[model samples]
Each structure stands twice: as structure tokens, then as C-alpha cells.
Target: MKAIRIDEFVRDLATLSPKDVPSPKPKGPRDIGVQITHAALTHVDMLYAQGLHQNNGRHVKPPFILGNEFAGIVTSAPPSSSLRPGTRVFGATLGSFAEHIYADENGLREVPKQWTNAEACAVGASGAISWGSLVSVANLKRGETALILGASGGLGVMAVQIAKALGAKVIAVVGDEEKARMIKSTGADGVVDYHEKDWENKVKAMTEDGQGVHVVYDAIGAVESGLRCLRYRGRLVIVGFAAREGKMENIQANRILLKSAMVHGYRFGEDGRQDPTRTEEVWNGFMDLVVKESIKPIIYKKNYVGLESVSQALIDLGKHTVWGRAIVRINEEAERELKARL
Candidate 1:
């Protein structure tokens, strides 16, 4: 089978390339073999490729495959598992950017009949993260206000739709006028251009009585600035550090205390690993929304086809040049299946 692996930590994207590797077989009673169809490009893949997340304890230094979420058909499954051979599924797995990979039955879910593998792959992890953060972590309620930073990124776009689905009025913060327009298309109540000096003020003004938002979805790592847009007792859910890396420093305790607000950090995969059942609930919930037409993932216009294109996809991800999600078509059959559905 073919896979993209990071043999060593190199600064350049050119360090990544396609290589032939032995296809993995199910090694556990709960494991199933997946003939992967589509893999989504993620910032985590970029960080891991450059060896930036080594000390995080969740991942080790590489010579490892490069994808986290994928949609595929089942080639092999344990007799005891509910999933059978030929089941169409989407889920998270290490080394997902390959022709074949093994994932536990617990992580895989049957994809809906109406969805293409590319659509499923695009929404898989990002939907889980958004649903987990909004519905699980923040407990966002109808009629509440949410200010979503980085509202045009892969996860951000999902966050916007999820927030709106939950009946929260959204104030989307994007990098420029173009992204603002893109986010506005999702029915956000207001859009703030972060490039503007008074963007925070703009967010505050958009909220009820200028009281600020009821929740802050801080993917941008602008926690301090995000705090400025919080309502009393508001929850700040930290899902990523797309804007900057490293721990937030010198934050005054009074900033949190004065607002009587709660600041929480969430890592979707880590949370899912610790509580598999809840993760399944989130995945199913998001899929239900998809089937019901309450929400939809915004896939980027560009297609990163095949394993060989993954390196450039990762580079574009790191540069923040691409919006929504990057879909990588891995198998010819999967591509044909998706097209046939359309």
C-alpha cells in the first residue's frame, strides 16, 4: 500500500513524499481494516510533520504516517464487530493518508447513504470537534451569543454552523473582508475583520446591550482579546492555537475573576479517547444534523488528489491560505463512487 510518512523532522514540506509500505492488518479483536478513500488535511498534520508537537505526550517523533481522519470502505472486520466487510465508514485513525489502515470498530461509524466519501471525510473530525466544543464543553444555549475567532478556518466554519444550529447568535471574526463575506454566508449575525484595530469593540457592539457574547470559541489563541468580548459568566472554550503556539502567559487572574467567567481548554481527540461513548454520541449527533440538513461542511474548492499531493496540502494548511477543509482523494474507486453519487 502507498502512504505518506515523515521519516525525519525537516523544515521543508519537500521532506514528505509517497512511499510503499506493507498494508496493515487488524491486530485486535476490536480492530477492522479500512481501505481508505479520502483523507482530510489538518494543521495537526503540519505540526507533526515539522516535529513541533513532540513534547505533547500524545504523539511521538515520527517516521510515521500523516493523517488523522478518513472515510473508507471496510475490507476486513472481526466477526464479533457490528461492522461488516464493505461497510462505508468514516473515522479517526493514525496513518489515515494511506491505501489501507486499521482502526478500532469503536472509532468507526457507518456513513449515511446520501453523503459522498469526500463529504464525510471533510466533516469527520472537524464536526466532532465543533459539536464537542459547543454542545459538550461550552453547553451553548439557544438565544445566547457566541463570538467565534478564526471563523473561516476548517474548524471555525463548522463552529459557525454549529453555533447557529444551536440557536446562538454568532459574531464571526475572520482575517479579512473576503473571509468575512464567506462567514456571513453561513448566517452569522455579525462579522468582524480582525485586521481592523477596533475588531473587539465591533464584537462587543454586536452582542445584546453591548454586554458581550455568552461564549467565546477561541481557536485563534487570542484568549486575552477573546476575554474582552465575553458576557458575565461566559464560557471561553479553547479548542486550538492557530494564531500562536505555547502557553498563554501573564494573564491577570482579575481578568477572569471580574467577569465571573469560565475559561476551558478542549482537545477533541484527547477527550474522545478518554470517553469513547460521548465521542460516538457527538459523531452521531453531527451526522443526524447533516442528514436533517441543519448543518453542512464547507469543503474548499481545491482538490488535493492522491497521496503525493498531501505535502503541498499541508503547506497550504500551515500558511492558512486555504479555507474550510482540504479533501484528498486517495482511491480511484472512492472518487468514482463520490462522482456517481453526485
Candidate 2:
């Protein structure tokens, strides 16, 4: 098996080595092994590489496999799971940068037969986040309005579609003209260029329903931006912080009082201590969305070829060049695609 890994403290993309590693052994009746076709990169990967992620998954040192979500075919499975060997499937697992990966029965989701690997690979992380935020966290209502910041990136684009599918009027806040146009095509009622002067006030102007938007789905937690966009008694769901710094942000009592708002910080990792049942709930919900065609992540039509490409993918994510989530594929299937002529 081959894996993409880092050694020393090198953060450059070229430092990631694609090399042969021992294949994983299946643990128990509940564990399964998958042959990976694609692995998607999350902002979490860059943070993990820099030793800045507060999440528990990245606490260990490097020379480890690096990936968060994957889409692949099943090669083996425990008796407990419904998955069967040789099934054409797409699923997600943590630390899946190699050709063959070990997956818990709960983490796997069967891909729709007609969906392309490129499409299925793109949806894994951001898709789960978006679907979970709208239906699970916010419990959003139809005919309501949502203010989504970072609405052009991976998760944001998914949320835009999901919120629209749920019958909410979406006000997407993106960086510039091109991104705004993309959101517009997704049926957003309005698009604001956040790079413009007084972008927040423009959001305020677009709010004719009441005090402000019905919900503020802020993916980027910059401490003080989205709360101000909320209507009286609106809910703000903290989904991502691609813009967050070292520490958590402070909440002002006055602002909470003035708006009568609630701030719920959400992290989507289901197995990590806080919420175990979340996986089952989110898994069923995610499958529902996938089956219904309500939302899909807008995968950029490019693939970053090798382990060396992982660094640039992370850098592009930091520089905001990664439009939607970019997949860092490091499996035998991907290896064949890039290294071999086909």
C-alpha cells in the first residue's frame, strides 16, 4: 500500500512523500477495509499539519497518513455492517490517505450508482456539515431566510443549495463578482460581495422580513461578524472557522441581549466524546439528502495529483483558491490515474 505522509516539520507541499506502507489489518467484526478511490482535503488538514488544530484527531506527530474524507469501493467488511465486498461504494473515514483504509461500519455510506467518483468524493466532508447544520443544528424552516458567510467555498456552496432546497430564501455572502455569480445560479435570493465596503450593511438592507435574517449560518467564525446580521431572536450556528485564530472568540452580553440571539458552536465529528449518537442521526440524514438530490458539493474539476500536491492544496485553501473542497486522493485507484498512463 502507498500513503501520503510528512516528516520533520516541513509544511511545504513538496515535503509530503508518497511511499509504500504496510497495509492495515481489519480490527474486529465491526471494522471494514476499503479500497480508496479519492480522498478530499479539508481546511482541517492544513491546521493539523501546522499543529494548530484544537481537535483531538491531529494531536499526534506526522509521518502519518493525511486525509479526512474518502470515496471508495468496499473490499472487505465485518458481518455487522450491511456493506458487502466488491460493492461499488463511496464512504468517509478519517486518516484515509492510502490505497486501502479501515472504516467503521457506521462511517460508510453507499454512493448512488450513477454518481461519478469526482462528484461523490467532493461531497463527503462539506456535504455532511451543510446537511447537518441546516436540518440538525438550525432546524431551519421553509420560507425563512438565511445569511451564509463564506458562501462560495466548499461547505458554503453545499449550504446554499441545501437551504434553498429546504425552501428558505438564501442571502449568500461571498468575496467577489465571480463567486457571487456562482451563488446566484444556485437560486440564492441575493448575493453580497463581502469584499465591498459596508458589506454587512448590504445584508442588513436585504433583510425585509423582520429585525434581520431568520438564521445566520456562519462558517467562518471571525469573532464579531455574523451576530450583527441576525434578526431579533435569530439563531447563529457556528459551523466553520477557516478564518479563526488561536483562541475562541468572546461573546458580548450586550449584543446577545439586544438581539435575543443564541450562539451554538457545532463540531461535526460524531465519534469524538461529545456526541456518539450524532453519527447515526447524521448518517441517516446525510443518506436522505443524497437520495433526494437536495444538495451536492460543487467539486472543482481539477485533481491535485500526488502527495506533493497536498501541500499546494492546503496552501490554496488558505489562499482561498480552492473554490469548493478539493480532494487529496492517495489510493491505488488515484495512484493509477496519476502515475499510470490511464
Top-TM-score structure, candidate number: 1
For model 1, the superposed segments whose C-alpha errors exceed 4 Å read 54-58, 245-250, 335-342
- Each candidate's lDDT (Cα)? 0.83, 0.73
For 1-342, candidate 1 gives per-residue lDDT tens digits of 899876787689866888998778777889998889989987767777777764335565667888888999888888898888877899888789899999988788887777778888887778778888888889999999998998998889999999999899999998877777778998788998888897788899988799899999988788888888898899999988776643444567698999999999998777777987888888877777787787776788887888989888888877777777888899858547645675
**What's the C-alpha lDDT at position 152 in model 2?**
83
Candidate 2 lDDT over residue span 1-342, tens digit each = 777654544546446666788888876568778888777877767766666677534454665677777877778887767888765456666567777888777667776764756577787757777777878888889988899888887788888888888899899988778777777887789998777887777888898744578888888774367877888888888887876633567767688778888777777774334776775676677667678877665776567765557767777777776666687655546434533542
Q: Going through the candidates in order, what is the number of backbone clashes in each?
A: 0, 1
TM-score, model 1 to reference: 0.93
Model 2 stretches with alpha carbons more than 4 Å out? 56-59, 245-247, 270-274, 329-342
TM-score of each: 0.93, 0.89
Model 1 clash tally?
A: 0
On lDDT, the candidate that comes out on top is: 1
